[model samples]
Target: MSGRFDRRVMVVTGAAQGIGRRVAELAAAEGARLVLVDIADYVQGVAADLRDQGADVLALQADLEAWEGAESVMARAHERFGRIDILINNVGGTIWAQPYEHYTPAQIQKEIQRSLFPTLWCCRAVLPHMVDQQAGVIVNVSSVATRGLMRVPYGAAKGGVNALTVNLAYEYAGQGIRVNATAPGGTEAPPRLTPRNTEAQSEQAQAWYQRLIDQTNAHSFMHRYGTLDEQAAPILFLASDAASYLTGTVLPVAGGDLG
Candidate 1:
């Protein structure tokens, strides 16, 4: 709505729903010509909605968990938009909900593929273009859970994301590409929490899930879930010239949960 990204070329991954979707919409409203990427079929609809709203958008479906997938998305953006000025990496997420001991080797790999590799691959794919142009902004979405209580594997993966944020920021700073991160506190939109096995879940598990959901509302000083708009603000700031002097910082979008 601010038109901060007027006429800019932007890409948002995992943008089919929830935080990712909201972020993409905000960027579009800010006048960005968008490339919405997601592993889900909903990406097409999301892109169509943006297009209907008068945003120049291209929706692409790709499995960002694979190297080829990242490459393909990057290629399509370059082919369609010529250059990418801003990238919002909002794809990473955990899948397995079991205890550390219950995780198999395959599950570990899967977790990394979904929760860590997307950021890494997107970063790798976009850096060359940014470096060549000597201008770009990247906002990677991480989680406060990386620091707060969480399952060990998810925490580890998100910790890697936090590290990647700083490292990429510093690595590209001299090249004129600014990179930062937005770490959200809790659910700000639908698809609210981690996916569950609804069919197999017992009533006790469902009750526990509901309890956690309720607790998330009061987990921060604000006593509420951060809104999609609120969570997207910091990301948009980092993606815009407003944060030109900022790099290597993990800006927490949490309501006073600096942890």
Candidate 2:
């Protein structure tokens, strides 16, 4: 593809699988040198496969929940690639769910760390490099759950992502940095969603989970879950120069399912 991102150094977190993996592959195909970071042990294998395809790729196993992890990833990217032109903060996931009274303090904290803190840490780590270069793109991955009613913790964390995107855009827009987010609808993909509806052990609880899934699938104009690639497309586009003039916006790729 003929585009502005050719050979640009790009870092994608949560890249071991799912939306993050697809985003990395597509970015690499577009001629970006990639630093794929994920806490998951499988990131090395994914990096190996991409390298075999002749892409300049590096894989780092890091828990982005730690501030150090975010710093380390950025430092490695600079050490290996010389500069960062795009940073896709694709970390975070739905780590926990429960009624408000049912969640412990520990569980609440874990969910926030899992679904929000990494984005904050990575953004903090990359902003200076972007400002120093006088140019960069940041694509934060949020969730459609933020659009309306959904799981309390996941939705709250994603809502924070949207807030962060807007604030960063305003603060960095004059500095030549673009910040935006993609909120993908629930997907029928592993680690994203699953075929197992009864992961909850209780019969009543499992039934409740199934009902939630059903309602979510029906919320979209298209009554089906999106594929991983489908969810990753907007994120990749925002990470590329194709979206040069876009920032501070949340693009929902939920098949029009914001209801």
Candidate 3:
């Protein structure tokens, strides 16, 4: 409500649902001009709802798994807004929950692709514009599963995200760009309209997923999942100028799990 983002041009990826949707809503409410991107068609409806509330918003449908998709999203943001002040890379999730040895090579690659490539591509695409402008902020959504999970590939990908955040912050500090990440614990939200995996999961897979949930709750001091707002607030904080002194940091919103 403080309008920390007044007049700011912000982009949020994976904005069709869940954490990304919450981020976009909050940012818009706080006075950001937004570009919301998602491969899902639901993103258009999200944008429309914001528009109804008088938010300046652009909804883009793109597959962020490829470099071109990332490039196009950034290009449109710049072309429409003239500059990008913030970017929230919220485009990732664990597609499968199974032991490492149980994962096939194809499954491993798909997991990596789902949970890593989008962030990597978006960062690579957005940097040139930020570097040229000499002012920007990037908030990557990571996960506490890095240290506890049945989803090893997801954990590894998030670990890579943490590393990317630190190094990018250091690399672009002189250019007035700040990069940080948030590692959220298990979160409670509505059932997804579009599930992460389309294939029918076997009984073993269901048990593995349950193990992931149990491990997540057990690792957290709160002993429960986080609300959407709990996860989004820290991301907005990192994006705002209030955190001007903080960069190259991965703040954990994991109820003391500190992954």
User: What value does the lDDT take at residue 211 in candidate 2?
Assistant: 64
Considering lDDT, which of the candidate structures 1 and 2 is the better prediction for this target?
Answer: 2
C-alpha lDDT values of all predictions: 0.81, 0.83, 0.93
Clashes of each: 0, 1, 0
Cα-based RMSD of candidate 2: 2.6
Model 3 is weakest, by summed lDDT over 10 consecutive residues, at 1-10
TM-score per model over all chains = 0.90, 0.92, 0.98
**Residue 145 displacement (Å), model 1:** 0.8
RMSD each, Å: 2.5, 2.6, 1.0
Q: What lDDT would candidate 3 get against the real structure?
A: 0.93
Which residue pairs does candidate 2 place in steric collision?
Answer: 220-257
